[model samples]
Target: MAGNVQGESQFDVIVVGSGAGAMTSALVAADNGLSVLVVEKSDKYGGTSSISGGGIWIPNNHHFAAKGGKDSYDKALQYLKAATGGVVPETRLRAYLDNAPKMIRHLEAKSRVRYAVAEKYPDYYQHLAGSLPGGRTLDPELFDTSVLGDELPHLRQGAPSNLLMGRIAWTARQAHKAMSREFGWRFMVLGLMLRFKLDFKWRRKSKFDRRAALGTALIASLRRSLQDRKVPLWLKTEFRELVVDGGRVCGVRVVREGREVEIRARRGVIFGSGGFEQNQTLRERYLPQPTQAGWSATPPGNNMGAALEAGIAAGAATALLDKAWWAPTIRVPKEEKPRGVFAERAFPGAIVVNGRGKRFVNEAAPYLEFVEAMYKDQQASGAKSIPAWVVFDASFRFNYAMGPLMPAQIMPDSRLRKEWLGTVYWKAPTLAELAAQIGVDPLGLEETARKMNEYARTGVDSEFMRGGNVFDRYYGDTNVKPNPCLAPVQKGPFYAMRLDAGDIGTKGGLLTNEHAQVVREDGLPIPGLYAVGNCSAAVMGLGYPGAGATLGPAMTFGYVAANHIAAAA
Candidate 1:
């Protein structure tokens, strides 16, 4: 299966994976006059990053400055300390902060990568010290995939759930309007309809959409930059072993198309092959029970931990293996992948309940916080909260979308006859019947519903403070009177979707220092080895500060790794 190769290839830097972090590292290394080779295990590039929201939380970014937003380094550090609680060393934290702006500038100057400030997106912990309401996160501008030419088909597509009309990409803010019935929204929807109609011809030819947004755009832009640099990217290449010589990682053995090949990395090998979220063995060994591969939002075959395993075998120390970028996800029977639900839980007329049919936390809380509450519930009572139910009434079903179930969209008769949907998504004419269908205590659900309805009537959630903060209110409906997040769940024909503990990816892997060099148990750098993205232990410790927390550090550390290698060279 080898394609006309008889011997080994060589490069100054060898990067594993083709996600944002890996591509950034490769591009930066190439910019520094290093010949870099990017090898991806999967047939396509981008990994899980292509399907993400493509937000990068870079404080003091140029976009923020361009928008006249004031952000100080000291204030950013204060926020980091408050969020991480001193768990992350000041040096590593400083390295991330100092390099983040540099990384953004470098990418914009050196490549086609460009970003716009998500001016209205708030930090997850907005009330915390040094936190801004917005202006820290950068979203990649939409990219035209037509530029990729033949490589377009090989690029990993964005998550289908994130797209609108199977091709158009909409941001959360855009979706808010598009879902509304306002005159402005109607005009926008009309425009989108026309665009989709015109795109039908292109879709027929390409078999995929050409307008890439969010993470898809981020990856496509990186791919274009890499192509311009003439960097060689080998797909279907699986890293087998790190070839170490005298305690230095000098080369790697990779299996490409069923044939093994040795490639020498003269300067360094950067591992950004993602986390262990898809590796069942590592997930069992590291994460808690019931939080394995099936529950992850990462694409299939991702985060298999091969890179981490190789690093560990080479004596690299690991950290934070028990943690992940947690999110609550619902498994749709018809969909091939589990969909991560965020805004739905925060909308009025809905509530999430555990097996005991009790609301344990504020439904309007951030997704990560919601999962943390679930974890807390599980710790209190084993497996009781693993499959929590997101209960909603007819009003909610008609007003808002939940996972794959669109607002006001009638379910087909064929799917309604299935028993699994009855089991997974309980629908009943009465609250007690819905509870019974989902195998919960009917009386308990009735009582929970009664209390929630009372809260809705009064516009107050005394029990868990459902709509207490700005962050909670971000996803709430503004039109609703009093508290936007409070609405009576008294409508008949209620529904419930089973939700499980899921994650964007595992957060733990090989430990790296300020320079992004993989460190051993002895606190010494594993020479010629570096790691970024989920393949490296996160610098945020265990706290998620804002949107794009995962990718911000990923790209920054990748930049750090490449610059260090270049400086040494």
Candidate 2:
């Protein structure tokens, strides 16, 4: 089960991929008195889940009661219907709303998996029929990895862009508190830094921090639970194709250690192998024009759509193959992954403009909507809008960080990395000079800045309504007057950074039914086959309802798939 084994092996359930959903499927199946095995394509077990922000958007999770919050299924469905724009079936959306909370509670009661309410996090579409400002998204607690023992090395390290100073880690609540510079954040940072610096035992092994936070915490917790359940997880095992017999998927043909191995699944084969964001061929084939594989913020080498392709070969239908979980990202030099440009755009004293030096969108919009606007603007205008510029003055440089660049007080020009200062990101003493530096029109930029100053004084964004929504104001600076997202950008020494239409991952893959069964084009379920996570057509369609929309439905469906399979004879 560890390696090629070079022969036939059998398990009650064969779960593909090692992310949150896959692990849940395996662990849950084992809980139901079935043997389970997990196969992962990458050497690391976590896939992209280890590097993600780790927010699970469960509509009515157990944590809500204790937090004095409540939600109804009908309200959740109404909001989803509006947000999803009716593209997804109502039954599928209803299934997710019904099962997500149950899944979270089941895992918490039976396994090491636990989540706390991210109290202040808001839903992406607050203006919809039913949207809560907080209490829906749950964040994983930090985990001590001493329990992982020898398996520690196999756990994936997070991208530098996801961590503080390219090394330190923080939980979602901690990150939000730190971003706002709220009280006790300094103490929290000091505690983590001291723990990291003082851990001589961990330092002897590797430079990585022993405490896993955010996505790493979630994955490590799941892995520990799987270990306790005696679920075998095979690394470097690639799903070559499905093995169907008697018109049912009975097993799979996989390549492990560069050799073919056929394994039989007595009950079912569940796919949680993520999406095709890392597959360039698929990106060019299905995605919008000007798309490139390098721009996706997903893990560098994983999710090449091999699993999705195998599912398609097995006659699983597909939908939304061209859509992605879009996010505005920046190409940070020396970093392996693109850093998502979240929160930074929502801060005051910042404006995102096309190459013509005109504001194109509300910088404080949801990340997915921000990128969608970028793509739309780029298509409407030419290449000028594809690589838009985020312009800000020295006040912004001193107050907030942009991409890889730290705040001015922490990382001044003298102490900054030479490769990034003037070439990768731009800086100048005046708007026209900054415009010249970034190839933006001087007059247009000057005029835009003047209007921005006027808007800052008036506290109104007539064009895009930057801070009009509660979602935008959640990340906005409360200290700012009138509008939390607006500020004058007339200070000297303006800075600019180029943005790319990046994403957390591709949102489309094998289409599935309400029970998480992979279905054919004829809307018939494929017995003994299920798909979850980014490898399945999302339940919310093109809409991102909340912070953890991706992981929420994924785990819920994985739970759904396991139950569906376990109920079989």
Candidate 3:
């Protein structure tokens, strides 16, 4: 039976989708004494942001600057200028850089969330002029999900790569070392566990999850803050349409318990419902390439571009529609998962080859650059635009961590073997035989292997500058002598996996003014409508700067949006 309500439903603000932006907006609005209602489409909250590497890049942040790190509004601007290459407007970039530190402090101090700087992480454009070497990013201190109790089930666990949920984040070297000395490692781990149970105990500041497991932490922090203030969170409810009255957005049409209900928004309607990554039609039209979409890595209910489409229907302008936040992926058919091969080039003696069996680009370059090179490869020699193969030798498989492989099957073991899944690897005693099995040119594959073997012997990668960056080396094994990226894939049986240009999420959507007010086609604000996060076009335009770049601005703009609306009211 449909739940009954007596009074007309209303709130000072209505926030759709409980991602980073939505949750931040809701918490900020409620804290400011405005009655706030947060509506989530899924049965669970904590959208994609929760399931991500929880880093937020806030360059020249006050915390870092105070700690003797070099930064300023001008330097931050200089960095962005050097990184962007003039594709995005200077005004938007300036706004994001200027407001970053203040927004971080505002959320941390005002809400239950606490953040600490990730001093070791580097900007994607560290080689670019004015880019800082490290420590401009931050992530939340682990928060206890058990505090939510009944709400725990509704708070989604982010992807396995997130380390904070109990997964220890180790580089390829650490993992290899642990596996190499299994018995001693098990004994040491058991000792640590015993110590944890007996002598060594600290404040239960929640289980210390690393950056990978931070999605739930961030969401739980926001949820706890909201619940403490008595803000209503209506989950499993969807925003159907804009309840417009006399050309102004007065409220929203929401479906709750199989009934259409109207919830009046007296202050504003905030759209934080994430982007259109799962919309295959949108992908075909905008991205125009077929890669493993990595739907398993994505939060299941992210299918609807509710915020993007809804805002567009209301005539909100959009930008960066032609580009997406892209990453190079290896779709391992054996595991039926698309693993980000950040360490592939860094792995000893591994080189990536195309369908024609030739080294394309430096395997150790940033993933964005790698994917861009692959796109160029697709255009260069008339290869299939959708799927390319990343072939490595037996040593790479046995020695290094190629990418993230989920320990468990999303599909049952029986269903994973089906040909349609497309993530399987072909192993053969010879490179030629392996190529034939995978439908590639055997001679080309042999030539590519021979060249890589020569490079491995010489310790020189003349074709592509793999392992040229500190970021690459960080993901590589230091145990490899001379050059980590120069290991030849000589050990057979060789392996090949199909790869596609997958993405974290789409960055294109509604255009907004600096204050996060959705701008209309005629350059006027959409009255009572504010959009931030993935629902809106990112402030950095088409390029992603570094890890946590997406969430940093999303949270900042979310705080900005709430403040602007509250001030206007």
Candidate 4:
């Protein structure tokens, strides 16, 4: 129950969410002499963004362009258009590219953000129609988390450390080889890590170099900057209603600790609250399958689709509500732990099988392809085939690196111990026994294993042609004799985990104009209302083109919205 509210408490700008978009907008507005107030519905401040890959793909940036990389406006626009399947209006793509570099520079110079290009991370479709290899993504260099002082507790960390900002290191295969043969590269990587650890340790930090820990660094820097600028961040405060006047939003009705307060804004209100991924009712209605609806790589608390719902109720145009930033994840049932096993599937030599106990699809295929196949399997006849199992042999477990398994190396030992305390799962010794434990047809499983061993012996993938792609081969261990991907699912004691369609988050929300303004159903711009991040259907449409696609657009459009607001003012 919220108390009746209101005197009109005013701010130059009132941002409704504490995500990167909202926070960036607030900081920009505040630094430009606007009195800003950021309200977050969750108990914490940073939303899903705080636990993300922490990459802002800003192309043609002056800093990056000087560092031996080149990205033209034409190239960036072409890439976006191709990635979006040509449905993305040219004007919108132009706005994103034009503003992205400025935004990157602005934040780097004015805010606490420090960025550098992910020089080695390649575009997902680099060989496709239009793509820029390294220029497309910009990630923050590890920031000084101590800058936040007391605000450190409010930050969120992603589950997997490798996906987090500034945690990139040589792969497990590369590390092993370097340590064994190339002592120079091994020492170099080890020395860099040692220096990184010592730097954090000297600062009296407890844990550093985790992916989630790295994310916390960026959030800390942002929070400290916001606090320094005196931007009021209302944590545990939820946006309940939009106070619209003359068909334009002028303020918001916020519920904080059961009290309603009306926050009036001079310029506008922005909805950066993410999608409704965790909302059971909405997911069941829009998502492809019942099992795919609830899983998330981020935290479970990111169920706020309030922005999208409120926008629809207020007659805003919506798009792609039935889709997600789709991903295929091994659903480690409710009893097991929930860290996404993408690395396991993405890693070489792993194979996914249906209940018929046969390799159904290419395990090392692109993420979207894997997800689509999972949806396709759901349409098949057998009830047992609906949720498939991702099978990997003992070779897969010990040789290849799986997601979040090495917690001591990737995440803080505490978080590793906390999240994975009792969730260690593996099966071996006999395929039949493993099948029985995982509830698959034993005969089918055995047949699948026999066929896989045949393919492994020949060093070719006959069914799926899995190692055919450059991406698949990029993660493959070339040293493996025959079929890097085909390691004879014959290892005594096979391992299988039940998997369902998982996602980074939901993908559908308010439709926005080139300026990132929320567009009405009739295609009229809803002044004073802007939406970005997962609160809007991505400009890239239904598929994630690359690793940083989500963060790339979120920051780019966020920059566009702020500039539009400033120019209008």
Q: How many clashing pairs in candidate 4?
A: 5
Tell me the tens digit of each residue's lDDT in model 2 across 478-497. 77888888899999988899
lDDT of 1 by residue, 1-569 (tens): 33633369889999999999999999999999999999999888999889888889999998888879989999999999898757778999999999999999999998999888887777888778899888888888878888999898799987776777656766545665554333487678667667766886686876445678888889999999999999999999999889899999998889887778889999999999999899898888988776668888888776699999999999999999998888898776655467788778888889988888888889878787788889899898653788789998888887877777767654532444475566457789999999888887788788999999999888889999887777677677777768888899889889999888998888899999999999998889999999999999999887899889988999999999999999999
Off by over 4 Å in 1: 1-6, 176-183, 206-208, 409-420
- Number of clashing pairs, model 2? 0
Prediction 1 TM-score vs. true = 0.95
TM-score of each: 0.95, 0.96, 0.86, 0.86
- Lowest lDDT sum, 10 consecutive residues, model 2, at 160-169
Off by over 4 Å in 4: 1-3, 61-64, 132-134, 160-214, 330-337, 380-386, 407-424, 454-459, 481-486
Every model's Cα RMSD, please? 2.7, 2.3, 5.2, 4.4
User: How high a TM-score does candidate 4 get?
Assistant: 0.86
Model 3 whole-model lDDT (C-alpha atoms): 0.70
Clash pairs for candidate 2: none
Better of 1 and 4 by lDDT: 1
The candidates, ranked best first by lDDT, are 2, 1, 3, 4
Please say which candidate is ahead in lDDT: 2 or 3.
Answer: 2
Candidate that beats the other on TM-score, 1 or 3, i.e. the better one: 1
Off by over 4 Å in 3: 1-8, 163-212, 291-296, 330-345, 404-423, 457-459
Residue-level lDDT of model 3, residues 211-274, one tens digit each, is: 2235567778888888888888898888877766776877888888887788899989998988
